[model samples]
Target: MKRIALLGMPNTGKSTLFNRMTGGAARVGNWPGITVELLSGKILLGGDMVEIIDLPGIYDLHGFSDDEQVVRHFLHDNVPDLALVILNATQIERQMSLLLQLKRLNLNVVVLLNMADEAKKYGITIDSKKMAEMLDMPVFLLSGKYGAGYPEALQAVARALRYPTPGMAEQLRSQLEEDAHLESEMARVLHHAVQIPVQMPEHLSDKLDRVMLHPWAGLPLFFGIMYLLFQGIFLLGQPLQLWVGDALGWLRGAALEPAVGWLPAIVQGLLLDGLYNGVATVAAFVPLIILFFLFMAMVEDSGYLSRAAFLMDALMAKMGLDGRGFVMLLMGFGCNVPALMGTRVMRSRSLRLLTMLIIPFSLCSARLQVFVFITAALFSPVAAPLVLFSLYLSSFAAAILTALLFKGKYQNNEPFVLELPPYRFPTLRQMLLRGWQEVSHFLRRATQFIVAGVVLVWLLTNLPPAAAPGGPDTFAGMIGSLLHPLFAPVGIDEQLTIALIFGFVAKEIVIGALAVIYGQFGDALGSALAQQLDWVQAYSFMLFTLIYTPCLSAIATLRNEAKSTGFAAFVIVWSLALAWLVSFLFYQTARALGY
Candidate 1:
């Protein structure tokens, strides 16, 4: 299949366009010999199947950022037949320089003035016909968000595919020169093809930014919004979780129990208590995961996520990072594995390593499930969201402390630059797709680890034939007992300690291990947990989970991205020490406070 590359500066609606074009059927894979991931999808154009590769959004073809270098290398090594140079219509005046850079590389390019609708809203207009004539290429006014002129855009691509641009890839490395007059050339093109209102009416984005980005109120408002997000997730997801739990219970009783009833006692125990109870317990949190991702998608697609980063840049700099690192940290909220991968955007090794260290501290959705379960079981409904929000705050606190402590060792000299797109309403389809992707990723990446961890926990709690399950003589009990003294100061009991051990594989398994530990599932598991520990112990356990070692997948990604086993090991060790220290202090202080 012929290859077409989607290239654009960051926040130019490149990803939105990719999703629109590919219908969210894109698959992410690494570029050859490079650790950077590229999203590719196939679509038929004019009876020909062509692949669309969404390259990393970069500001310049020759910029020093990791993404920019990746783009340059990919173009040189595997040049696409056509590069769709997407430019944000509202910012075309400035973004046109990137297009000039690509042209200098001798790549066959089609200029897509994306977000035409938003441009019109800003009292800006682009004459695509004039632009096409001026730039000697096809220029199409398109809105990637709402599919305006989408069919025409595809038709243009189909037409361009017929006339393959030869010698374009070969010229990439040799022809890339410092275009000193590129600014004047872009100005010449824009002067003819674009019009901007001198007295442009104030936009809703501007009106909102005045307050949302205000130095005094921005940080507090960001936190308030995040707090509400958690509250909303709990309020909306609690009943759904209950329903899922009940459904799982009914399935176990109605189908699984009968299906496995004829098996031997040992086999039944493994299948039912080990697998069903464990997997089902974790599966019950799926609703919250979906809701959380959806909320994050809204924040992201609305363009406020970048604003959050901008708002935090000052504070982040103090912690040896920037707004961009904080954005990756926020992405870690969805999953640390990808967030760790995202650190590749930083050019400096120290910056990437520091960001990698801090990202794992994000209370990912996996840990979110554990916190949601614990908070629901221990705290009142009114206090549950508060408790969950506190965990999030603590996660950031842990990340900040880590950055401050390690800033000297891992120094970042690179400057921070980020694009803040205009605020717009996120389409329902986009939000749903984000939720689906996150939930699907959670299930696909987590199922094996969760099942294995829970089964191991089950075996550890049920082995030796003569001992009672989860009793002192069982393997789990023995291990947990051995470590109970060390954990006791932090409010972790033997059973919870066993769960923590399994949790190292994947945090979702923490809930599953708990199910196995208590010899219960669904509502019974929650009730069992409530009986096992008070609110203070439960909170302490959450703090420990929040700061403890990241999952195996995250550790592996850290090793790969940091490219140093020693650094990865240090991360694990430091996180472990921090977890113990924080939990011990919190438990001791809470006890001292007579709570």
Candidate 2:
């Protein structure tokens, strides 16, 4: 199999092109770096199994960083038959530097002019054939996001790989080895191979960025954007969330509820109450997950996400991260899996790890749901929003504190530099596909873990033949009793403890599991919770839930992104200790003040 390495500077649509080529069939593995991984896939192109390797995006391969070194070493050690370099066509002048550098590595090269549509709107036109002639490589003008010109490019690469040849890599290297004029030579090629209108069309992105990238106005605008984002998540996701639960309920009552009566009580408990309920619990939140991702994908596709980072670079630098890491942290509000993956945008290992660690504190929509449920149930309508707002503030505080503590400890040498792409309108197809991809990845990774957790909780709550579900005689009850003295200071009890145990599976499941533990449902469940716990304890429990742990999927991501099980375990321990300390202090201080 001939291997074609996909190389590019970051944010050139390399990953999108890779996904299109691989049909979303990809596997990830760490090479030498603990923070980032190599993405590889096998595709049957032109009746041959071609391995498509998506190498980490680096501006200059000769630059230092885990990603730079990783790609550099991979090229030297395991030579690819061909290199397909994706470049942002809007900024071809600066992007061509990497193409020139690749020729120095003596590898066969093909230039992919991505985002051609955006470039065209800027009155930029490129002569692909002429550019290919001057650069001594194949240049394909296409938009990776829209599936434009892909089939022809793939076929060309397949044919080139099938019929080996001594290409211009050697000839160019000999001419430019020590010439130190790669930039001038690149400018010369663009001079003949491209044309631009004397008076360019007024770019829409520049007008938007003028306000969005403004130091004074940008922060407030960003906050407004986020405020609206939450409003959408709640307005759109909540009703669908309820519909999902109602649908699951209807299915249970109409189908499984009757069938379970015929099975042995134990089997019924395992299936209906345990496995089915557990899976359904997480499944109910699917609407929120999809809506959140849909909105995020829109922001990402419009290229506003990069601008958000560029706007926050200076403020974020104090915490030992760049605008990109902060952008990843902001993404954590939607989902942590993609947020962890987003850390790939940062080239430094330390920056990626620090960003990943802070994401668990992003007050993700899942956790937000739990906070909303508790605050609404415990506080008056006038106060509930304030209470929820405070919890969100707490999440941000914790994230910033975590970043400060870890920033200097694992500092890396690479300075953050990002190119802001022109913003374009997000297509419906792109939004839907991006949303589905994230939701599917979340379901695939989280379902089994959640089901197993549900069963484990069911067993602990219903063992010994006499103990009622979540009763005082079961193993969970006993464990809670033993640990209550320590937690009692923070107003924790067996029921809340059991909910927390399941909450570790997924934060959104906390409310559903609480309903199970209390044997209550619908509006009655809130009243039951309010009766069982006072407002102070209720708020404390919510705090503990918010800070204590990342969901199971996040833990798995931490392991993958951090590249060590030990680091993942450390996150668990650190979060648990911090949650305990924070909640204890909050409760104790409130009590001291007679709240």
Per-model CA lDDT versus the true structure? 0.88, 0.78
Per-residue accuracy of model 1 over 1-595 as CA lDDT, tens digit each: 8899999888888878887777777787877746667888888789988999988888777777777778878887787889998998998878998888877767777889999998898899889999999888889999888889888988988888888676453444534455668878988998998999988788888889999999899999999999999899999999999999999999989998899889999999889988889999889999988999999999989999899999999999998899989999899999998899888779999999999999999999999999999898988998999898889999999999999999999898999878778898889988887677778879987787988888888899998779998899998888988999999999999999998988898898999998888879888988988998999899999999999999998999899888899999999999999999999999999999998
TM-scores vs. true structure, each candidate: 0.96, 0.86
Worst 10 residues of 2 by lDDT: 167-176
**lDDT value for model 2:** 0.78
C-alpha positional error of residue 582 in candidate 2 after TM-score superposition, expressed in Å: 3.2
Clash list (residue pairs), candidate 1: none
Error of 1 at 114 (Å): 0.6
Per-residue error for 328 in candidate 2, Å, reads 2.4
